[model samples]
Target: MIGDAWLWVAVEWSPPSYGLPFTDQEFDTPTTVALVVAAVVKAAFLWLILRAPAPGPMDRRTKALRRLLYLTVAYDLVLWYPLALLLDTVVAAFDLALWTSLNVLFLLVIRWRSRALRATAGTMFALELAGMADALLDELDLPELGSNDAVGFVLALGGAAAIVLTVVGQRRDGRWSRGTLVAGWAFVGSFALMISVVALADMLFSGGLVEGIALDALGLVPAVWLAATARELPTDIGPADRPPARRRELRVAMAAVALLPIVALVHPEQSAHHSFTGASPPCYDQPHFGDLKPSERDAAFLCQARIRYSGVPPIFPDTLPDQAVLAYGRALCRAKDREEEREILTRAGSERPDSGMDPWDLVYVCPEVVGATRPELLRSAEEQKAANDAYIAEANARCRDPWPRTKGVAQATANYFLFVDGDPGYLVQDPGDKAAEQAAGLAMDRVYDDDTLIGVGGSAVLVGHVEDVSDLCLTVKAFRAAPPRRVAGWDYVNEVPIVSRSGQLTVPEMDGGDVGAGAPMPNLAIRGKGRYRLRVYVRADDSGEQHLVVVFPGASRKRLQLKP
Candidate 1:
């Protein structure tokens, strides 16, 4: 199965479509047949053991060994059934490593007295450790192991040596006939062959599917061979025949060997390398957020693709960056499969609505942490939906007429509104905010005393009123702090248009009655909900400069009757 999959991946699965050809053909019949065969073989192996003369009053040591043997087989079954018949994840990639570990552990236990067997365990353990070392290097962003094939080649040579030693050492022991020794060594040799085949297959067909039926059928070959050989071993053992002194060494060696492969194959690095940073379908060249790092963007793409395609669940690093998680949520929201998209997105977060409110507008009002806003604390999708529904319901109950979004920030009943303008480049130009607090306080005080003032806030420039206009917007553009020569000490950009409620456009005069030409903002009609314009009017005097605040009308979609 591994061989076929590897072949398919290399020849058939190419870039932009690195997956097996889905035939819609199920492997039910073949899988069932393989399972039935394995069951019969297992039952017979158990029958042979139970039917044997109880080792002539089995010793405690013998009983323990028998228990361990049973556990080995049981564990194999536990992992194999689901994997062979129903597994669908990338976990299948580690099947070879897991099987080899289990087999080596079993062999080490049963054949502890043989020096040759111990040597084989050591070699395999070392080879597995090298694989793990390579994985570790990759995770650390270090140079990768120069050649995976080099490790495989070394392991194959070691396996051959192990087989030869197994035969020679078993023969010297004289525990059984030459036939038995050769048969056991043949099993060892077959295991070695299996490892080589699996490795080569992976190299050939990296990410394609194999014939499930053939795969399952082939899996049974080792189990049947192992069982058949085990059933034939003699039931009796003498006290001297068991090597107690060597058991501890064998156990330690095998335990270490078994654990290395699990660590290498199941580590987080194994799952994260297959992300779609460059791909178009899974990830676009220009992502939703282009500023993200390659790793962050790739994580986002893979996170969404796994959910969309029902691919293997990716193992993420424990300490994923905050931006990366946000990116993943955004990508997940773009999935075409609405059901899965919602399921994954809601689990992460609701995709942040593109409010289009410029960050420059809010920086003056919010001098601290203006760019640090994150949606990590948003409520679950269901709760958010409920909140939205409740707000809409309450709004409907209060107002008889439907609120048209085109009305911008205007309310149905309110006649007066409050607005304030501050230094457009205050965040960038005067990040120290030497005069921001006083200016904002003065403007806020004006609104607090007035009844017509619905809401008052400061913005850098007028962004035309529109649907999804948020109060805060963050731009990466650099702010130039260069001040006008006439203004002195502080930077002043330009004059801004002041639109009357009756739709008249005029520039507000500065402190010297100088009508400075202002830059054109988004021209928006002064409907009740239209965008409000605020311009900082700088007045030069002997005591430096002061900005005259003019109040325009600005309101948010949400309304509250503070005075009425």
Candidate 2:
């Protein structure tokens, strides 16, 4: 029954995942099988023992053996299980070491009760420890016989030996001598001390001080119980007096010893490396990437390849300035003999002294290159009104709205300039009272959901308003002349899209502004050299017809014509 219980507990506590190379699902079946087999074997052994004749009345030897078995079982249940399994997360390494130590101690106790059982139990324990060491060494990639591993092994073996000596003396002398008593106490003390040291070392290296201390305190209970119980067994009994119970007691001890090797054989090994040389398999014999099949290799490569960007900017920063977008644009213009496009690029490049022509020609500009401005100052009332009037006239010209009333109407315009061939630059305009501002705020909030989206920018124009509109006309012409769908490679380049929030649009606070020549809004470029998509959310004070026009270099103008 005790063996059955221990087996069940071991299966529950460690499961197969504890040290095996099986997936999670595999553990369930194997664990159930192992536990059932162990229980059946243990039950059979117990039945046989009960049927056997009592060797004799229980003698001192028999009593001592019984006490040792009880102690070992109690220690394993109370100390080893909780510390190793229950408190694994906080002090996994420490718990493992302590559990290993307890196993050694338990084997030694069994050996003392029945020397004939030693060959089996000792060999099993040794092999199990060897396997554990092998796994640890492989996992940690440590040097052989490192200080920690050597000390731990010595402590465990020494503790086991001490228990054996104490048990042997009691059997021979009928009572424990003062020296034996002291040694027994010292063994318990040393065990506790070693556990404390291991816990503390784990705490210092890893960060679980509170858990280490708690587990150490819990470990003391079993140590005390074992020492006190083992000390009570009588030291002597005559052969005739012990005959009745001796057979059963010895049989139980032998069964325990035999079970060890069986358990060891069935125990799946962990893929850990031990610090000891003899504990591990040779490196060349271990599995490696090359051992994977062709299918696996193909799958791995495909998984990596899907995320590669063909023309998109590298996500990470580069030491050399990013110039892909500007260079691509310039090369395209030069190939097409577009002198005006080349001159525009050259002028923007020359303005920045340090970078010379490099900044303007780069695929994208660093956000730092664009000077900071108050978000409010990006547009003014007069500029906004004139732009709105021109937009309305243009819209009216396109679609005849006989009864147009533009009051309380939201308006906005967004323009995107791309130097390569892909998605053309986009623009959005809201023209209804203060609705545009609300729309922009909502859009900004959405873009910044993940803390990644930055600001937006583009030229704001009032169509069909100015009598002498050479400057405004030139700005539009210049925008129309640039190549389409091409990007400027600059620092901090990213692709961002404006997504609208749900529900009716609400107008936010708006300080009406007019955008005109020499206004900061026209020149207020953020990260000056990169292509951008501008979104304008606005409401016209009075409505006739509102036009949100998006002009791209060398592409037809996209006009969002609306009337309110």
Candidate 1 has an lDDT of 0.38
Give the Å error, residue 382, model 2.
47
Candidate 1 Cα misplacement greater than 4 A, ranges: 1-61, 79-149, 152-211, 225-236, 239-564
lDDT scores of the candidates, listed in order: 0.38, 0.35
Where is the poorest 10-residue window by lDDT in model 2?
469-478
Q: Pick the candidate with the highest lDDT.
A: 1
Pairing residues by index, what is the TM-score of model 1?
0.37
Q: Give one digit per residue, the lDDT tens place, for model 1 in 225-252.
A: 3333343333433344346797677567
lDDT of 2 at 53: 23
Which pairs of residues clash in candidate 1, taking residues 3 or more apart in a chain or in different chains?
6-204, 6-205, 7-205, 358-473, 359-473, 359-474, 407-529, 408-529, 409-529, 410-529
